[model samples]
Target: MLVSTFHRCFVAVCILLLSACSTGYHGSFVERSFYQGDITGLNLLGPAQAEHCQSYALYLFPLKHSPSTQLAIKQAKRSQPNTVMLADISISDTTHWKIGYAKKCINVTADAYGKPPSTSNG
Candidate 1:
């Protein structure tokens, strides 16, 4: 009985850790926060006016899908996300079976654009 209890606790802890790693960003980012150098020469396929476009991989808990969107916005390294456009989350239900619990993972692709950071003349 003691071993079973310990096993359950271990599984719970593992799940918590995995969930934490997936939520890397929060709120928004400032113009200076992005590595502008990276976006400039990224060779974006389509011609964009002010913002750069990029794709980000997201794994969300279907139920709490909002946070994933925020994370994706940050991934684009955009100071202002004019719109958070995301492709349909893959329609797959397969998950890793662990202790009879299925862990969900789905890819969320996105495209974003915004005004570049301002250069202050301080």
Candidate 2:
């Protein structure tokens, strides 16, 4: 009886742990990247690329918010930091209901391009 009870408790604990195991999602495709921090605006030269991030709370409600321009740009910079970000910023987010998640997020997007050759130190 004790062994059975222990097994049940262990299973319950594992289930709870798995439910909220993952938080935050990020994905990017970059030819090259480096952090340029905050900038006033982007001077696009090359073709533009965009990166957006969706930050969540309980993972169920799509929490729409602001100030993600810097965050989004930073993420984009991570993809190709040596590039550019045009000043058109958009913000939005969505929620995905999975078996174990009630996901929410805030999305930020901006146009980007490779930096000029003259801007490179190395």
Candidate 3:
């Protein structure tokens, strides 16, 4: 009975270790914030300008550091985005908003979320 218990414990430990390692396969993405105020009073001159402005919020999510990142960057480079419209006049009192573009460097890691390893040789 003791031998069987020990074997079960050992298997459980191995499974936990393998599960931790498997998380390294996925990556993460970050979204930068933009406010409607900063981009107000700007003109977006194009045939599809109105449609682009309607979906502007979708552009806030940056590319993840994975295969998808390459594709997103390529698409962004090909299409230049223009700004249009301003914050609603009723909501102009808010000044704590931020608007800008951000570029993140790709980091390779052997752990999840590109976090550094917990164990170090030193």
Worst 10 residues of 2 by lDDT: 24-33
Model 1 regions lying over 4 Å from their true place: 27-122
Each model's backbone clash number: 0, 9, 1
lDDT of 2 by residue, 1-122 (tens): 99999999999997787565444334333333343755543356533334344444455334455235456556644454456544344444444555644544445454555545565578
Question: What lDDT does candidate 3 reach at residue 106?
Answer: 26
- Candidate 2 regions exceeding 4 Å error are 1-70, 118-122
Rank all candidate structures by their lDDT, best first, as comma-separated numbers: 2, 1, 3
Evaluation by TM-score, superior candidate among 1 and 3: 1
Task: Write the residue-wise lDDT of candidate 1 on 1-122 in tens digits.
Answer: 99999999999998998677545533232232233343443322222112212222333333333234334334433322433322222121123444533344332333333333458999
Q: Which digits, one per residue and each the tens of the lDDT, describe model 3 over residues 1-122? A: 99999999999998887456334434443332133454333443322101111111222443443223333333332233332321111100111112553332222211111112257789
Worst 10 residues of 3 by lDDT: 87-96
lDDT, candidates in the order shown: 0.38, 0.50, 0.32
Q: What is the C-alpha RMSD of each candidate to the true structure, in Å?
A: 14.0, 11.7, 22.3
Model 2, residue 37: distance off in Å is 13
Ranking by TM-score: 2, 1, 3
TM-score of each: 0.28, 0.38, 0.25
